[model samples]
Target: MKKLVILGAGTAGTMMLNKLYKVLDREEWELTIVDQYKTHYYQPGFLFIPFGIYKKDDVIKPKSNFFPPGTNVIFSPIDRIVAKENKVLLEGGKVLNYDYLIVATGTETRPSETEGLKDKLWYKDIFDFYTIEGALELHKRFKDWEGGDLVMCIPELPYKCPVAPLEFVFLADDYFTKKGIRDKVNIKYVTLMSGAFTKPVASKMLGELLAEKNIEVIPDFYLSSVDNDEKKIVSYDEREIPFDILTIVPVNMGSDMIERSGLGDDMNYIPTNKHTLQSDAFENIFVIGDAANIPTSKAGSVAHFAAEILTENLLSAIEGRPLDAKFDGHANCYIETGQGKGALIDFNYETEPLPGTFPLPGIGPFGLLKNTKINHYGKVMFRWIYWHILLKGRELPIEADMSMAGKYRV
Candidate 1:
């Protein structure tokens, strides 16, 4: 029997496993998934924890719960991948050879990458919402705290859920206002990007929203280090921004195993055919989610859409057909602008986010680029959809490829 091994078992890995299991012939293929952690985190929900919208229980579940019954699930750390030999070396010296490999070992926040980021102020005045611990700890710090300069900083790019920092400041505005301390809390959004977002239209809309919320945006500030002693963040050009409480989206990097295997770039992200989701180095090896250096938002929606395309391409490769299915770098993001209002954006490669209704023209329950309570509801309802429909590889109402039906270029 041939082996089909999937690494990581995170959102991308688990979804791929379920998608392939139904299609691959059981008699000819042996399915397996490997990961270091036993718990699966709904990473998108991590942003809500600091604001008390979601709790620990809501974002976590046993990894075993999602795997199919016959799957050979291995909860062990990966040492490295011997790509040339088509074998994976686990920590205990055990080896698993695969006929095909899916590298879904997602990206991670590296606080250590920045100087003084994990120093004395860490988990005290400085916290990241990327991790469960950081989010929960920030929640505790926010509970009884008198407000001051609430700094939400993005040190670098390619972070998971790019809109999260914006959401953080937006929710902070609502959170403090409800606590009767909106005036006391001076919220600031600091980022490496020139505007509020990568896309021009969305950035204008979000930047205007920030201004209306009385939050300041400091753009193009490349973070050098955190001055824990003086309680300030210093930029590379010697600009310093003082903070009372620093909530940061730390530098994100792909798994070290990618580096160990010599299959990744400088940041450890696997160089992939963005249109095909196949590793540029190895034809039998595919990459998905944050692991691949795909020029799109490292959001769950991107993974979901890419998974559909990947499933088709992998099957074609198995049957010796041309891998013709293409992933258009499709990404759909829901931005929570706080106070029961949110905005949605959908686009793919060669297209920027546009203003219009989503899924249907002039008849969407959720509006694109327009803030509405229904958009907020769409986000709220997505958590359920993620667990039930998305992770389970069930077909969603939206198509894998992006459509130009409702969107209008401005």
Candidate 2:
């Protein structure tokens, strides 16, 4: 039987596995998946851990729980992908050859990439919510801590969940206020972007919200290093900001195995056809989610949308037909604002987030570009949807390609 190998059992890979498993002819194709970890993390839930909205138990489950029965799941680190040979070399010297390969190994935080970031003060004064350990540590620190200078910094771009830093500061505002230390806690949002966000309209809206919340926004600050001894983060231009508590989004990079494979870019992201989600170097290889160097938000929503398009394209390719399905780079995010409210944004490659209703042209239960309690509820309910529907390869009401029906230009 021809072999189909999937690398990385993360969200993208798991979704694809389920989607294809139901459709692929088991008699003709042998399906297999590999990953290094035994646990599956709800990465988005990590954002809430520091705020006590979620606990360690809420974000984790066995990797086996998500895999479909009869799957040839191998828990092992990948050494490298030999694309020309159509083979994957695992760390244990096991070799697997494939007729088709799907790379969904996602990006990861590299705190060490920034000087002094992972130093002695790490998990003491400095923490990152991108990882479970960091989030749990920060939660512990926040429990007994009196508020001081709480600084949220984004050291790089293309990080997972672009709105998370903003959400962190927003939630921090609420958390400290409830603790009755809001007055003592001076929250500052430090970002490398020119504004609160990358897009203009959304940035303006979020920037105004930050100001209203009395959260200082320091823009264009490129983080150079952390001065663990002095408790300050220094920027490339030599500006230093001292903080009592520093929460940061570290530099993110694709899997190291991508680097070894020589199939990746400077950042170790695979060169993929943005529209097709297919590797540019190999016709039989496809990349999904954070692994592909696609110009879109590296969030689960993008992966979910891309999976639908990819499923269609892959099946077409299997039949020796032209790949007709195209991904439109659709991404949507819920920005949690303080006080039980959140804002939503939906856009594709050609469109920036705009103001209007969502899913339904004029009658959305969830507002677009507007902060509302209902949007927060939508985000809260998504966790259930993620575990039950999304990972199971079930179809959502939303379309794969972005629709302009409910959005309006500002």
Candidate 3:
């Protein structure tokens, strides 16, 4: 029997396991998935946790609840990937050899990378929304506190759910308004980018929204270090921004195992073919999720799209055939603009987001590049789809490739 080992039983790995379990011959193939975590987090829900929209129990589940039978689930941390020998070294020095390998190891926030950021102020005056602990702590801090300079900052880029930081400020604006403290709280946004977002058009739109909300922005501010003692953040350009309460999105980096294996770039992301999702280092080793250094938004929707094409490519590689499917970096996300409204965007590697209808060109219930209440409902309902349909490898209404049928040029 041929051995197939998938590392990190996150979104990508779990979906691939369900997809392949039904197709691959049980007698000819044995599959195993390894991860140190027993709880699976609904990472997208982290943005809502601080707002009290999602509780701790709402965003997590046991890993065993999702995995289908016929696959071995090992709960252990990985030490390194031996790509040359096609084996994996676990923390306890146990080795597992495989004929084929899939790397779905995802990224994590590293606040320690920034000097003084993780100092005394962390979780007290300073908080982050990327992890459950941070989100829960911020929730308590927001409940009984008086208003001051509420600063939301992103230290660097290439973070998961790139729209989340924007969503955080939006919700904060509305939350304070409802509490009758909107005038007392001065909201400020500090980002490393030159605009509100990565894309030029979207940045302009979001930037204008920030202005209308009376939110101050300090663009092109590269974070150098945090002065926790003074409650100020210093930038590389030597500018200082004082904050009473700081909510930050820390520097995100790929798995340490990728770095240990010598298969990743400076940021620890694996060098992968943008279209094929196959590792450039080894033909048998494939990558998905935030682990691959792909030029696209590191979001969950991208993982679902990549898994569809990757399953086909995996079959092609195993059978010694040329890969037929090519991923187009198709990614769509719901931007929670607060007050029972949200905005949606759909685009690929070539096209930028523009106004249009989605799913059905002319008859979309969900508008593109436009804020709508239904879009907010879609965001609320996606939790059900993620648990029932997505992890089961069931097909969604959307396709893997981008469609220009209803979209106009941005």
Candidate 4:
């Protein structure tokens, strides 16, 4: 039997495993999934953890529990991928050969890439909401924080959940207001980007929201070093931003194995065919989700949409057919604006986020580019959908391609 090996049991890999497992002829193929960890984290929930919306118990589960019956799972760290030999070497010298390989090894934060980011100030006055540990630490620290000049910054772009840092500051604004110390606390936002987000229209809307909340913005400030002793972030242009507590999204990178294998771009993301999900270097290998250097938001929505296309293309490849499925970089997300209200944005490679309804023309229970309580409910209900439907590889009602039916090109 031919072998199919998938690396990383995260959202994309897990979903792909289930989707492909049900389609591939079991009589003719064998499948194996490898990951370094046993637990699967609902990463989106990491955003709400610092605000105490979700507890630790709510966001993590065993990776094996999501797999289908008759699937092979190996829990071990990988050493490197020997692409020349089409083999993967495990940390302990174990090797696995594959007729097909899928790399879904997602992006992760590397705070050490920044000077003094992981020093003594880490988890004390400095924290991140991207990881479970960082969020939990910030939660504990915020309990006693009097909050003076709380500065949050993004060191670089291409970070996972691009809008998350903005979400954090917004939630912090509401969080402090409810605590009755809103006047005593000064909330400030710092970013390397010129605005609140990457998209122009969305950024303007979000930037206005920041203004409405009375939060100051430090735009276009590139970080050079963190002076933890003085609690300030220094920029290459010699600009210094002082803070009482600093929250930062550090530089994100792909799996180190990709770098070691000599199969990645400078940032270690796989060079993938943007529309087809095929690897640029190898015919039999595919890259999906945050691991692929696609010009799209590295959010879970992008992965879910791409999976629908990738599965079809993979099946075609296995049958010696041309890959016809196209991934249009479709990504949609619920942006929580605090006060039990949220906004939704839908767009793809060819289109930016437009002011419109979603999925149905003028018939959305959910609103777009507009904040409402119903959208917030959709955001909360998504956690349930993620565990039950998304991880199971069930087809969602939404289409893989971006729909312009409900959009107004304003």
Model 3: worst 10 consecutive residues (lDDT sum): 401-410
Per-residue lDDT tens digits of candidate 1, residues 261-364? 99999999999999889899899999999999989989999999999999999999999999999999889989888999999999998898898998899898
Off-target runs (Cα >4 Å) in candidate 2 are none
Give the per-residue lDDT of model 4 (tens digit) for 34-99: 999999999999988887889999999999889999998999998888877889999999999999
RMSD of 4: 0.8
Taking all chains together, each candidate's TM-score versus the true structure is 0.99, 0.99, 0.98, 0.99
Question: Where is model 4 more than 4 Å wrong at Cα?
Answer: none
The lDDT of each candidate is 0.94, 0.94, 0.91, 0.92
Model 1 ranges with Cα > 4 A deviation: none
Model 4 Cα shift for residue 118 (angstroms): 1.2
Which whole-number lDDT from 0 to 100 does residue 134 have in model 1?
98
Rank by TM-score (best first): 1, 2, 4, 3
Model 3 regions more than 4 Å off: none
Q: Write the per-residue lDDT of candidate 2 for residues 322-350, one digit (tens) a residue.
A: 99999999998988897989999999998
List of clashing residue pairs for candidate 4: none
